[model samples]
Target: MNEPSTIEKGGAEFEGVKLLLCENPLPPIDETIEAASDELPRSNHYTEPYSAPLRDLLGDRIGVSTEHIHINAGSELIRFA
Candidate 1:
């Protein structure tokens, strides 16, 4: 993730909010696979696709339909005002 730009400096408008800035925090492929394995259901040898399971787990937390959720492989390069 990109660092907050000068415009996003903590100020009255952003008070009480927490921000997490990361350059690249993803673990290696093997580690990610191992972590995912632990989350898989033990009773079923086959598992649901990635998006479906994630949506089920995070159903109401984000307040948006799963169709609106997107997965990007790299950093988001665009910015908006």
Candidate 2:
């Protein structure tokens, strides 16, 4: 926990800013981003079973294999066991 620091709300900073611990912005780095508008497979089908390439990349990022990862759609309902 952080000691509540009072913010001056008069001169340059009219809006009082509250510092949070859970979030912090690091300096931006060079990275590749794929846009949805990019041309891709036209096959109107679900990536059945799983998408190996996506899983592979994800696993590599977190230092794990695809077998150790699980995926879920945001729209799909999940039940807590």
Candidate 3:
């Protein structure tokens, strides 16, 4: 009998684009620094699962429902991919 195949899908079947990571070229602004400092106290806690506030803002600007918004941290995206 033939052995079962371990490979699930071939490379040609990949339908997603590859994303690359790079260091930020710009320095943080005063507002960015202030926000980071403010959040430092809550650094130990995990961020909201869906980042509702940011999603809400984006949804309003784009005329889409919050349910259509999907947010992911840069590190999480890289790790998962």
Candidate 4:
């Protein structure tokens, strides 16, 4: 048997689906916009494998070494890890 369409599977037509909790409705602050703009020149480069700067900063704030810190792109990546 063929699989049903999304509307058929859902038993109604869904014009769209929005996960409001997944995003911030407010616009980014000036500092964030400026920082992002500054990084545009280096956007072609791949990010460092370990994100050492971020890890170091977080480790310093929490009184831990970088070895103890782990950062994942998202919950989906963490699930695989």
| Backbone N/Cα/C clashes per model | 1, 0, 0, 0
Two-way TM-score contest, 3 vs 4, winner = 4
- Assess the local accuracy of residue 72 in candidate 4 as a C-alpha lDDT between 0 and 100: 59
Which residue pairs in model 4 clash with each other? none
Runs in model 2 with CA error above 4 Å?
A: 1-34, 39-43, 72-81
List the candidate 4 regions with Cα displacement exceeding 4 Å: 1-19, 72-81
- What does the lDDT read for residue 45 in candidate 3? 70
Ranking by TM-score: 4, 3, 2, 1
Q: What is the alpha-carbon lDDT of model 1 when measured against the actual structure?
A: 0.55
- Candidate 2, pairs of clashing residues: none
RMSD of each: 11.9, 9.0, 12.5, 7.2
Candidates 2 and 3 compared: the better one by lDDT is 3
Ranking by lDDT: 4, 3, 2, 1
Candidate 1 local lDDT, 1-81, one digit each (tens): 544433444553432335468544555699888887897767365434344667755666878777665443344522344
lDDT of 1 at 21: 83
The lDDT values for all models are 0.55, 0.58, 0.71, 0.72
Model 2: number of clashes?
0
Return the top candidate by lDDT. Answer: 4
Clashing residue pairs, candidate 3?
none
Q: Candidate 2's residue-wise lDDT over 13-52, tens digit each?
A: 3334465797555643434223333435544655544567
Model 1 lDDT at residue 28? 64
